[model samples]
Target: MNQTSTECVRVDINVFPTAPPPPPPVVGPIPEKLLKIMRKYKYNWRLDQLSKPKHLEKKFIAEVVEPLKIVKVKLPKLDPEKEYYADQQSIPLIRWLVINKKLYGKQNGKKYRKTINRYINKGWGSIYNFYKKRERDRRLRQRKREAKKEKRMPDFERFTKLAIPKRLFKPQSPTKKSPAKIFSNFDRLDVLATPKPFVEEPVKRLGVNPAALTYEPTETVIRLAQIPARLKNLPKPLEPGKVQKSALRYKVTPRIETLAVPKQRNEKAKVDEDYDPWTIPPNVLKYKATPRILELAKPTERS
Candidate 1:
């Protein structure tokens, strides 16, 4: 009533205040006795020297310390044939083709996909993951090599192999084999695909002997003479001579594996003795370093 027109002032209030964080929780002070004991022991406190260290328990050593101990475990031998990657350098098929002037002088996404797919059957998986795993393996190998190098004698030759030349990795042209040709399409027409008999054959049911279906026992226990007719289909007993001598059969011949083909397989045989068709093909590299007699007539000797 004194002001007749009283002005109302609106004040903006903040729900959350932005301020520096409160100090961290105060840790309880170390016991004066514990502090004195720690000071006496010093930083280099030898637990083993202690008569009865509280932390050094038998259970602690067995359960915790033993497992925590560092061990140099021997790695299993890796087979190059099994562990070897075809594309270790991680070169993309199209990229390789381009570099080598292959791919029929074409550069496109479709061609790239097709080229990549060609090597997929040969165990090419996700390129990204493959390279990642390869890098990880390479790092581990490097670490092992470094450790070995440190421990090795100065006079002894280190296992430092000569680096492979980039030219050696020249991508060989993919063989002129097509997927369509590899997997020939053909419908299976075999009627005996399933166990179901043909229209002409009788429907066979699996159960007790077929003879039992028609059997009609004349008495509670049939005479032993009738046993022969009842057990006609039963297997015959072994004869004295035909009986097995030992648990393991001696006549069995273990498989003899021939690793390499015959060296002189392709050599011309006498006219009387024709070449064996089933013989393994000759190795061209068998006489790689050795010189052979010339079959062609010499220029000087020829009339």
Candidate 2:
């Protein structure tokens, strides 16, 4: 028996519907009308329009409506339920706010929320407590080190008190000498010796001639007369000059004529041929002139 074959065709439909084209591209929280108002107003837009409530409605419209009418291009979408954390950018902003109070409200509210969340995660109370404990421990450690240093120092007064008593009170006193033994021998010698009685002899006068012995004068008495009267006196008179006429006559003569004969000219004395006064330099003859010659050569006319 020949049977006719019928081919079956399989149609595969994607169960997820291609994820609905990623729910269109999330356009913006800022709408066209809001953007126009923002452009007109510059930075003075209403806070409620820029807030979370308006952003949620705008996000829904962008997620649902924008891509369906277009070429169905998928773009990145932000989750409405999850928080957008900008902690990296917000930390410097928070630090700036803490340093400058004027920037406290001027910062973006979202950035402030992210910074507050980060600080909460890092535990602000724990950081403050750690610094406080560190300072306290440092002070305690410093005090303990100072106490130890003081304990190591010597107490000079206590050392002095212990030393003085040991040095002053250790030795015994020396024994005294016996006075009775030293004086016993001296007493016996004084009792044994007796003093002799003094004897009296008669003094007699003998007669002698007065001329039997001749008196002699001492040599020292004769030398007394030889001493000069001027030497005995404290001061003496000056003597008058006794001039010798012969000596005065001798000194008045020229020294060369009185003391020596004149030197005679010999055959060896020669006349100098070069002794021309005009040829001689004036400076060479300065010491050769007599005083009388110098006076005679003076100018007759006064200047």
Candidate 3:
């Protein structure tokens, strides 16, 4: 008897991905709500990547980064029958473990390392050169644009003079006034009397001003005929927004000197009659507390 056997062939297509496709970043403009936060962090960058710390791995953590889910660890079965700690056995931990995260994986680390090394080697200088190159390119582009604009423009003055309307350029005869009569009809302005200026009288809190007593009415000061003319001798009515020249002088009235007071002492010592401290008093008045009177009452101890 002949037996039939079937041979099976397994074709495993090894689809070793070149690199796992990067996650879609939640990139956006610095949101209006985040403007104050950006200013506080001094991260005033306009790029979409600068504000996305999770995907971009830029400087500090940003709001775009989502917090990791807490992991719960179950407690060991110390007492299986007890139900008191049943609900509380599994503890949820909210902590940041500094282990190798997805961000530090082999594929993403190369770029981060490259940038870090670049920054370490030359931080400010590289940024400066990049901006300088951009500015130079911008200036070159502007020059080219201006040159193109100039080439496109026609010579303005080369064209024929604009057709000016007759009403615009036509000259008209000016009205000439008749010659004035030279005879002295009105008094000459030069011959008019010059009115005296009203001088301001100094204000006194108590005594009346001496200059006000001899005051004369003038055109500059307002004259209130109803009241005594002497009362109007005060300073001229100031123009609405104008301040008096004296007001700007800031003269602090010298504070009146205070009256002198009798000398007083804060000690119980009485004022004794004058006596020379150097002169020795007679035996009756000699001080008893001298070195001889200060002898030690106890026997002196020897070291």
Candidate 4:
């Protein structure tokens, strides 16, 4: 009603209360028991003066910060064949989100999606590139090992030279003269001229009749009957006279008393006129009768 007269008066009405800045947003003191628990569990938390905070900042730090700090993270190994990635560069970012579960929430659920995005934007962009390079290097080493294994395989040429053919193992034939050539000189003449068959003829001195004896004719009798042409032409012996014996006995008879007289001894006596001349046969003189000389003689003269 007093301003009804249109008089301008500046009255400051504070929409947000400036009552001593709301007593500087009262900070609850950390309990000694909770601090001890945090010290024991938080492995990565800095206890240095530069990182320690005098008062907690609600905007920057969570109201009930988890006591545990993750010192290490373990990601599940990727099955490169199955996972769908935008490119090889996205591999490590995915690995980081999976492993650092505390940084991003448990199970990589929606609550931690924003944290993942923030890490990707920040200097963590090169993580995937580094992982891809390592994967490529490992694959190269594996390929090199496979190449070395192939090189070490046995060479076919080496084995082929060592292998021998079955035909080469056959035994060698003996070197000897043929049977036909050894008996070439044998003939029928050699068979016929061998030796006369020996025949045992019985003597009948007791005036026994020859017909009365049991007589067996031998091969010698048959062979002798077939006389050679050369021997058949030879002359027979002359017959002796019985009457000449009486005439000769009377003519040559000297008185026994006169013949008994001492005769002069001669060292070389000539001959008696009545003695017959000794004639040597031609075959007997030419033939070699000794057994040793016959054995060493030529084959034609052997028998």
What is the Cα-based lDDT of residue 185 in candidate 3? 42
* Model 2 lDDT per residue over 1-303, tens place: 336866778999877633222223336696788678656764442443356363344343544545445467787776653323433333343344454434553565767756655654443234334576577679999999999987999788888988785445768789787676445586667767756678886666466645655656589878875867777775444335865556578655587676678545444443655444346666877868889999999977522
Cα distance off (Å), candidate 4, residue 149: 1.4
Candidate 3 lDDT over 23-88, as tens digits, reads 354387657777776557543343445556666455866668688999999977667545544533
Tens digits of lDDT, candidate 4, 1-303: 675678677999869854221113227997898678566854323333446778987786658867888688788977775453434444345556646756547566975777666755442345445666678679999999999987998778877977856565668798887677455656767997899899998874767677767677789988887979998787655345545545667754478768878766353433555433365757989986788887777465321
Q: Could you tell me the lDDT of residue 252 within candidate 1?
A: 42
- What is the C-alpha local distance difference test score of each model? 0.57, 0.59, 0.57, 0.64
Candidate 4 residues lying further than 4 Å off, grouped into runs, are: 1-126, 155-303
Residue range 1-303, candidate 1, lDDT tens digits: 577889889999879966544435338986897678666855423432455656855553544544567789999977775455544435355345445445443555666656655654233344545675678679999999988987775533333333443455678897886567454443353544556755786668777888998988776557643657656776566565675656355544344234343445444563538667666556844644423334333333321
The number of residue pairs in model 2 that clash at the backbone is: 0
Q: 1 or 2, which is superior by lDDT?
A: 2
- True-structure Cα RMSD, model 4: 54.5
Looking at model 2, the pairs that clash are none
State TM-scores per candidate. Answer: 0.12, 0.12, 0.14, 0.12
lDDT (Cα, 0-100) at 155 in candidate 2: 84
Q: Of the candidates shown, which would achieve the greatest lDDT relative to the real structure?
A: 4
Error of 3 at 68 (Å): 68
Off by over 4 Å in 1: 1-156, 159-167, 179-188, 193-195, 198-303
lDDT of 2 at 146: 90
